[model samples]
Target chain A: MAQQTLEVLQSTDLKPKPDSSELAFGKYFTDHMFMMDYAADKGWQRPRIVPYQPLTMDPSAMVFHYGQTVFEGLKAYRMSDGDIRLFRPEENFKRMNHSSERLSIPPIDEDLMLDYLKELVKLEKEWIPTEPGTSLYIRPMIISTEESLNVAPSNTYTFMIILSPVGSFYKEGINPVGIFVEDEYTRAAPGGTGNAKTAGNYCAAYKAQERATANNKAQVLWLDAIEKKYIEEVGSMNVFFKIDGEIHTPVLNGSILEGITRKSVIELLEHLEMPVQERQISMDEVIAAHEAGTLQEVFGTGTAAVISPVGSLQYKDQDYVVNNGKMGETAKQLYETLIGIQTGRLKDPFGWTVMLEA
Target chain B: MAQQTLEVLQSTDLKPKPDSSELAFGKYFTDHMFMMDYAADKGWQRPRIVPYQPLTMDPSAMVFHYGQTVFEGLKAYRMSDGDIRLFRPEENFKRMNHSSERLSIPPIDEDLMLDYLKELVKLEKEWIPTEPGTSLYIRPMIISTEESLNVAPSNTYTFMIILSPVGSFYKEGINPVGIFVEDEYTRAAPGGTGNAKTAGNYCAAYKAQERATANNKAQVLWLDAIEKKYIEEVGSMNVFFKIDGEIHTPVLNGSILEGITRKSVIELLEHLEMPVQERQISMDEVIAAHEAGTLQEVFGTGTAAVISPVGSLQYKDQDYVVNNGKMGETAKQLYETLIGIQTGRLKDPFGWTVMLEA
Candidate 1:
């Protein structure tokens, strides 16, 4: 860990800027970025804030061939006092390091990373959108920089942070979306790198997502690999269901990412004096509950979508709508409470927000 | 299909060149290189041969985040008469494009790519190690170049060629290596990106490979995902077993990579009036054959190893040795035949070699 200050390099006039209103999710980026390099001789180098520019690398870098990369996605919110704040920044840092360790990449100092992120947000505060549900999306990534074709852990690496402003995850806001129950393909396996936020996990889920999209669905609801019966996740998000007046979610099975939002929701539920359970929930159980009219709601939690109310699930050619295809009351309460905490409207009793210096 | 002439950025100096006899795999590189760019508006740009220099890419490139990349590996052998020849490079080109299509990345023109490669090998001819069982390894890669964080395909890409001088797949001549059967985790799955020669596939195999190494084995032997009983591939290479005087291999089944060497071996076997069967062979069947002394040989085929003999298989706390834990007659014959065809020592009646101008 070093206290070296960030070296800033602003983008020149030639760099095109996108329209704020027309920002299409992650398709647009900010003017400057953060980067740090790791070599066998020198440890993590002096972190720098530079003009968003192309990285100079050998054609045979290990990351280009072995997929030795990991990344984290979180957002910075604009407060009423014109200040930028990150929600649960420590959680993101912890998860990013966990992903890095799993991918054999070097971990960053949590305090150093938080300080650097705060400085980055303070410098690019204007990029924090004021629109409801809109914010500055920050992507922190680490890649193997060793210039060799051998199949081994890299001796050189680079850690970089890039920002992009995005609109609401649920574009229509609080609307219910359909999901295809993915049984044929597993995003990850037990004793595998599934829990790590690595690039391969997302790539593994793409085919199922493509199939889901082709069928006019939003995402794929993944199942456990062993029997393909137990619900694992929604690929990129953790899932929660309401049945018998209790909030239930699949426990951390090492095959699903331990999402920050998932933890936040569980804590929020417990704080609100609601019954919450974390255990393996099988597909048969869910179907039986739906048939018995006991299945109340289903929603997914992620940084992108604070809460996505699942309207219907298509499994084995059978469709089952949740709560008559409406956003559940529990989902609505969780969404509002979470967003309120993120935007500083709620009390900071949980100590989630890390405000950047103005 | 633009025919813009390729710009040549020749290397300024040869630098400190390594001796051919002491060359390590993927450590030493050539001086000149080939590259091209593609964009949604511009399509595939004209190819180029440039000096071997570091490539400049955006820190936020999709390849860094989503692993939107694929690559191919082949070699350029220096014939006795000083001409350079490639073994079935067309197969490599075709497979690379197939992998790109799966990843949603654009493909390169075959003729143009070959032309660029020829130009590069011609300029860097001095780096080709003139030794038996050794050649200059050629690596071609495609990556997303767009500086965006979107999960979808990128609008821009770069295709580049790099050359690395290598010794041989086996350091101790053509000896047989042992394999550890992996039953818990799968390398690839059905209806997934298994058949594609993508980076993610190789990365996914690393953990299994690590397990094999820790267990003092050479490679990981994969099994079918559905039953975990049938033999599949050994990561990068295709598997083959000689049983009851017949050559048998697992069928493609959409989950196995259609290896070029695998196809070549089948053709060569049929040409020699030998029985070659492409069907499922269960692990139990293989073990039973070994116990009954019917399984004579086991080997793997790929561009890197050409023909790698498997001396033994370790599975379920048991060891099954083939041909008394030594290379079998069939393994030796296939290796000699394939190497002969590649090194210009024997006639390539199939017209597989693509010669490059000196």
Candidate 2:
């Protein structure tokens, strides 16, 4: 197949960018957005950067009826040197293809997609927030556009990359959050779409999140669907538990999302000579550790929240507080280091950050 | 709450309707559709019947990214006496609300929704197919319209009812279908959205359906996610088996859909003095029954097919032919009775059909 050329249509009436302080996650969009279409006969074609606008879709579009969609979340940071950098964007595209495979949607050329993304970021460089924790959130998504009610794979799709200027995820500065251990609701199972970065997987957890909120918790800690025993994920992020002196996380067991930040965290820990084990850590083990005074810290990792510390866990009518309801020493250190590397304030030892040309 | 009034807007340009032979499932649409909007503060409002057209949605609508949507399917029939009839549409609306509750979507007033449906169906009565086994398929759906990237319930929603003239589900005249037993992928787990008529639940089964088609089977039979032993559903329909002259179906566990047809079938069986059982039916027990020649017949029930006979079961590299690959007597009876009642030909003893005023 021939390489497709990027077609750019700059917005004629560019809207004023939101003030950095007023920016919330996914609230303020940039003037221009990237879009691509996929037809079964023509492959992915008509890649263009168009003005941000509403989508005109047939009411019978497959995405609205069958949930055949996949999405990736990452950010473009404005470095102190006035250069824009994206943290492991190639990884997001790669994982996106994986998610598309599971959702039965056609894949895009990852390298070409990344090139298009960089071009978009470079064009909208002014939109990238330079605040200490704020950056331009990049949402790459694919939705089935076939106007059919058939419960099958769609013949056409729409892939879009929309940029949003956002404030820091930790609006109150990385404070530890209380989690509700959900036993009544299941996010994913071993043979389901849990691992895929699909829309269904995220929305399916809304009920559990509501229950958590009702219980006065900030987020939910989901357990396995079958046994409701082993740890899976916390809210939308991959979770980590510091037992004794080592970091333990649930293995990528078919159902758990292979979060890019989770992978980077493991690699960073290994580089720093800190112990990290990826295995099935059951709730029993976590509770036992908490009782034994060995459960030092708990945190979640994802593109949205690079490092979210867990202060307490509510499970089976019992509350288990961790590290005195405060962010742990390791969480603080990792958060700072990861943020430093992402913002280009520190050296990129793993070559994880990709710089956009001026 | 005051009952909302429905506004009707006739189509100025009506499209040509397809011939009876050209009628296929959900391929063609009617001239007008019913629509309603729901806001967190205003509830469901502005119910209207407008020209069938495309929907203008924000690119970042929650349904496209988070799958916060639900849908229901039923049919309208054009009776021989020139009257229009709906088969258990009230049940569909009720179940749709149940599905909405599970997906964290606000429920629509079932009575008011049904009134709107009747108004729309009455307006498009000409679209109802009159051919034998043909009807106007009614698809009622609710989609989250909030333009947010957050992984939570949307504050706004769109509810729509689209009509499609559909021919017989069995183009080949009610022939039995071969079933592929899916052991690798799961449709729904105990705590998942399996019972909800949500978009995610349907699309998540696409991969398994593809596998079934590749194996030269007509449909897939899903087992429980936890054990992969008990039969859950067959190609989006409730499954029934006959062992030693007794009708048995999987109980309405949290993972199994509460199919209206399944319920009616059980009721009909009991009225006919046939022994019916709703309990967990394991694959091992099924295989054992087949070995003993007691597995007389197997079939599936849903709004589309009414009753679909299972000719064969492919499991563990072995094919268990049911009733010598022919439609069983009971399945034939149920199909004719259900179709007859739905089409207003047979006596409506159970009052399942709702007729629209001329």
Candidate 3:
């Protein structure tokens, strides 16, 4: 297929960018956004960069009623040397197509989409933050736009990429936080839309998240839907445990998200010659390990936090402190290494960082 | 609390109503719609009946990315005496509040909301079809409108009700549909948002529906997410099986929707002194009954098609014809009685119909 032309219509009225220190995640967006429309007859067409503005849609748009939408989150960093970088962006787009398949949405050309993203990032280079911990968060989303109330898959869709200047997830140091184990609510189950980065999966978790907040915890650790025993994820990130001297995480189950950061951490650990295992880790086993004094650490990995260290776990009305309620060695090492590579301060041995021309 | 006043802004240019014979489901909409907004501080304010038009929302609206939405389906019928009536609209509003609770949305005043709906329907009475099977389909929806990317509940929301003139679901008489028993993809699981009439629940089942469609079936019969042995729902509706002259439906498990139509059917059957069991009806039991020549009938219940008779069920590469590929006597009786009561032609002993003053 021939590559589609990229049309750019710069915003004549650009909003003043906020100070880097004042940036909050997804609060402030840049002046321009990338948009594309898809129809069953026209495929994907009318790709353009336009001013960031509100969307006008019919009241009966399928997305408003059916939730046929998917999204991806990544970041663009403004390095100390004044260059822009993206870490393993191709993985995000690839996973997006995988999610699209599950949602019955048409897939975008991965390579072409990546090229367009780089173009978009290049045009919005001035919006990228130069702060030590700040970067520009990119949200690419697709929503069904058909003006029909039918329950079937929509014939029309809208794809958009918006950029937001986000502050550091850990404004202070990487302090360990408490997690509440959720047995009443399930995040994903086998044969469900858990692996897909669709809109429904996120909001379906609000009740449990609210419970965690009420319990004075930083996040909720989700369990398998059936048994409610095996750990699936923590908050919106993949979870990990340091048992004795080795790393352990749940395997690539159908209901758990295939997080890019989770994959990178595994590869990095293997490269560093550390023992890691991907298998079902139940709460019972964790309790057993904690009793045996072998539960060393617990952490979560995702695009936003990268590595969120868990200090204590509240399960069955008991609080189990891990590693004396402190960030463990493995989490600290992984965070520093990943941040260094992402910000272009370290060598990209895995060739995961992609650079955009000024 | 004092009831909020409803403001009216009628549309000057009314749309030409489609012919009752040509009406299709959710296609042609009425001129006016009911809208209300909810904010953290204001609660639900600005209740109004406005012109039906497109919605202008920020590109970063939470509903576009997180699927924080809930909706309801009902209908307004034009009686033979030239009166407009609604069947259990109070029930719909009550259920909508229940759905909103699950999605973490603030509940609306059900009685006041129902009053606003009646006012809106009265204003658009001319759009209601007078044909035997035609009526104005009412869709009430609530969507998260907060312009943020945070994975938390939105602090702002929009609630609206739109009307569409829909034709009869059984234009050529109530023909039974073939169903494919699905063991691959599950509609929902316990601890998930299965009971809520949320947007995510519908689209998440599209993949399995597509599989059923590809197999030349009319709908997918979803099984439980865990064991994949017990029946859950048929497509988006509640399922019922008649074995040995007894009606059996899956119990109100956390993973099954509390359908109003299903409730009505059960009540109607009990009033008629028929045996009805609300318990776990596993696929194993269904198959055994089929082999024993006791699986007399199968059907689905929902708002769109009050009673969708299942002629055959394709399970594990085998087809089991129910009632010899025809609509059973009980399903036919329920459909007629329900339709007669809704159309004001039969006595509504249960007081399910709410008449709207013309």
Chain A TM-score compared with the true chain A, each model in order:
0.97, 0.99, 0.99
**B-chain TM-scores per prediction:** 0.97, 0.99, 0.99
Candidate 2 per-residue C-alpha lDDT over B118-160 given as tens digits, one digit per residue, 9 for 90 to 100: 9998889888888888999999999999988877899999999
Q: What is candidate 1's DockQ? A: 0.47
lDDT by candidate, in order shown: 0.84, 0.92, 0.93
Residue B131, model 2: lDDT of 81
* Docking verdict class for candidate 2: high
TM-score of each: 0.91, 0.99, 0.99
Q: After superposing candidate 2 on the true structure, give the runs of residues whose Cα lies further than 4 Å from its correct spot.
A: none
- lDDT by residue (tens digit), candidate 1, A262-312: 999998898889957999999999999999999999999999889989999
Cα lDDT tens digits for candidate 2, A1-358 = 2488789998899888888789777878888889999999999998899999999999899998899999999999997688888999999999999989888999899999999999898999988989889999999999999988888999999999999998988877778999999999999998899989998998889899999999999999999999999999999999999999999999999999999999999999999999689999999999999999999999999888899999999999999999999999989889998999999999999999999886
Across A275-305, the per-residue lDDT of candidate 3 in tens digits comes to 5799999999999999999999999999999
| Top-DockQ structure, candidate number | 3
Looking at candidate 1, what is the lDDT of residue B313? 95
